[model samples]
Target: MKILVTGCAGFIGFHLSKHLLEENNNVIGVDNINNYYDPNLKEKRLNILKKNKKFKFYKFDICNEDKIIKVFKKRIDCVIHLAAQAGVRYSLENPDAYFQSNLKGFYNILINSKRFKIKHLIFASTSSVYGNQKVMPIDEKSDITNPIQFYAATKTSNELMASSFSQLYQMKISALRFFTVYGPWGRPDMALFKFTNNILRKKQIDIYNFGKHKRDFTYIDDCVNAIKLIIHAKKKRKKFEVFNIANGKSEKLEKYIKIIERELKLKAKKKYLPLQKGDIQTTSANINKIKKFVKYKPSVNIETGIKKFIEWYKFYYYKNGK
Candidate 1:
């Protein structure tokens, strides 16, 4: 199978593309390599994928309809759309970025996938879509009309838009609601990466919500594995579907930090702070549907996942004396 993965230079996209290539499938990856965080990190990820013979990469923004159409001229079996302006706090600052990438860019992808008669369109959604739902273990059927953050609003819009596309064209679309994803090659903006760096630097780490937030931190590999299983599922494809891909275990923010500190043998100077706007108090995923449909199992625990990430971080960053 030939898979086209947008945002292939990104954290999840990079891991997913590498996994697909390992499965002996041809992977065509595309990313604009925007400096949302660090283009250097994105470049490093792309360079690793370039080494694989089964992988082909394109440098283009997904929002460019012409370039996206040009890339689809070749047969693409399935498309895993992961490109978007990510970050809740960032969205509050620049709402236009979310509109452009999440809304406009997604529209371009959907139309092209429909134009090419693609079989499965697997796209990334977020647990943030749940948006203070007043419940634990959020399900696919949860009320997502009121997204607290503009970023979540864009993703919720993506789900609605994708559903319309699926219905209109009878397309097989899967919107994966990813929980707090963390692991190796993670974005510097993410908590795990920032906390690890701060702890290593002996800087004060800001503990949001007075260290009371609980998140279902899904490991990158586990998240990618769930995606692989869903894409390769032999069942008759549904016209539209949504699933929660998560570890199914909610861990406290403080505990998460403690594990990282233990792994690094460095205690972090903690500064408890109030939760910022556009942030949810808790997030837990109800992944029963995903498991039932695709036998998806999240095997990586938070401790093990953090250890792996720390090892990679040290090797990738510390070796250079940065």
Candidate 2:
């Protein structure tokens, strides 16, 4: 299969691209390599992917219609669009970035995919779209009307926009509402990486929401595997089928911290702060639809995933002398 994976330098994108390449798939990966946190980390991931012969990469933002269209001129089989402006808090500081990348970028991908007549278009969405829903296990049918942050609002908008395109263009599209994804080569902005880095450096770790928040911390491998399954799953051109790509488990912020602290063998100096705006109290995904369709079952638990992350983190920082 010839697959086009956007955000190929990103945490999940890097892992997914490698996985597909290992299976002998021809993968053309792209990323603007924006310095949302550190472009160095992004470059490291891209370098790893570039080592594979089956993998090719282009450094361009998805918002560039001409470049994207040129890439589509090839006989592309499917698209795994993961590029977007991530981070709920960052969205508040810079809403326009989200609009340009998440919204406009998504628009370009959809238009090009439709023009190219790609078979399947799987894009990334976020659980933040659920807003402050009191529900424990969020399903695909749950209401996503109340988005507390601009980031969540934009992600929800993406789902709606994708649905409209899918219906109008008769394209097969699936939006995966990813939970708190974490593991090796994970985003520096994510909680796990931040916590681990701070703890390892003996720096203070911010315990947001007074250490009361709970998140469905889905492992990176599990999330990527679910995506791989979706890639091959029969795509019936339904009007925007959305699934919560998660482990269906929730872990409290404090517990997750303890695990990281233990793994790093360091005590974390913490500052407990009130819940920030756009932050949800809890997120647990109901992955029934994905499971029913693709037999997707997350194999990694929080403890095991954290262990793997810590191992990688140690190696990474040690090699870098940080």
Candidate 3:
């Protein structure tokens, strides 16, 4: 299969692209390598992917319609769109970036995907779209009318747009609502990385929502595998489908921090703070829908996941006291 993967340099994109390449699939990669966190990390992930002979890369933003069209011209069979401005708090500071990348950027990908008749278009959505649900184990049928964050709002918009496009063009589109995914080469902006970095440096790690927030933290490998299965799902799926790709378990914020501390063998100086704007107290996903569709089950537990991340983090950033 010839697959076009946007944001190939990103945390999830890098892992997914590597997985696809290992499966002997021809992967055409695209990423703007924006400095949302650090372009250096993105570069590192991209460099690894470039080592694969079956992988081809294009350095450009998905918002560039003309250039994106050129990539689709490569006789691409499918697309895995993971490129987007991703962050809840960052959305509060710079909403324009989110609009440009998540809104306009995804719009370009969606339209061009239809024009080229790409099969099995799988894109990354987020569990944030469910907002602060009163129900436990938030499912695909939850009411997502009220997204507290602009990032979630944009992702929710993406799902609606996908639903419309799939129905209109009879396009086979699947949106995976990812939970709090963490692993080696994970985004530095995310919780696990930030906590690990700060703890090792003996810096105070801020615990949000007064250390009471719960999140369904999914491992990178499991998340990527669920995507791989969906890409080649043997069953006929609905034109537009949504799945919650998660660990099927929720861990509290403080509990998550303790895991990091245990793995690092060091205590972290913590400061409890009220939930910031666009922050939710809890995010739990009902992954049964995805399990039914693709037999998707997240295998990595948080204990081992954090240990793996700590090893990678120490090797990458916690060395030489730099």
Candidate 4:
């Protein structure tokens, strides 16, 4: 299968592209390579992907409708649209960036996908869409109308746009509600990466919400594998469907920190603080829907996941002098 992956240099995108390429699929990768966090990390991810002769990457923004349409004309089989402005807190700082990429850029991809008669268009969503619901486990059917954060609102809008496209044109589309994804080659903006970096350097790590937050963390490998399974699922295609790609184990922030400490064998100097605005206190996923659809099983526990990340972080920075 020929797969088109947007945000190919991103954390999840890079891993997914690698997985798809390993499965013998010709991958067409695209990224603007913006400096949201650090382009160095994004560049490193791309460098790894470039080793594969089957991986074809174009350095361009997904917002460029002309260029995007050109790529769509390349007889693409499926589009795993992962390019968008991510980060919940960052959305608060720069709302315009979110609108341009998440809304405008997504529309570009959607229209092109529809115009090209693409087989499937699977885009990324967030568990943050389920906002501060007074519920335990969030499902596909949960109320996403009340997104606490601007970032979540953009993703919720994406789901709605995809739903309309799927219904109107009978386009095959899936929205993946990814929980707190973390692991090797993780985003430096993410909490795990920041925590690990601070702890290793003997700096005091800030704990938000007084370390009371709970998150359904998803390992990078498991997240990539689940996506691969869904893409290859032989089930009758639905016009629109949503899946929860999560470990389904909502662990507290304190416990998560403990695991990091254990893995690094270094005590973290902690600075507890109130939760920032646009932050979810807790997130848990109800994955029965995804499980029934693709037999999705998240194998890595948080402990092992953090360990793998720390190992990669050490090697990536220390050995490579990154």
What TM-score does prediction 2 earn?
A: 0.98
Residue 219 CA displacement from its true place in model 3, Å = 0.4
Task: Please list the C-alpha lDDT of all candidates, in the order they appear.
Answer: 0.93, 0.90, 0.92, 0.93
For every model shown, what is its TM-score relative to the native structure?
0.99, 0.98, 0.98, 0.98
lDDT of 3 by residue, 72-112 (tens): 99999989999999988999999999999999999999999
Q: Name the Cα RMSD for model 3.
A: 0.9
Kindly report the root-mean-square deviation of model 4 from the true structure over all alpha carbons: 0.9
Off by over 4 Å in 3: 320-322
Ten-residue region with minimum lDDT total, candidate 1: 313-322
Q: Return whichever of 2 and 4 wins on TM-score.
A: 4
Q: Give per-residue CA lDDT, model 4, range 140-253, as digits (tens).
A: 898999999889999999999999999999999999999999999899899999998899889999998999999999999989988998889999967899999999899999
lDDT of model 4 at position 227: 91
Error of 3 at 307 (Å): 0.3
Query: Where is the poorest 10-residue window by lDDT in model 3?
Result: 313-322
What is the Å distance of residue 13 in model 1 from its true position?
0.7
Candidate 1 residue-wise lDDT, 83-118, digit = tens: 999998999999999999999999999999999999
lDDT at 293, model 3: 86
The root-mean-square deviation over C-alpha atoms between each candidate and the true structure, in angstroms, is 0.8, 1.1, 0.9, 0.9
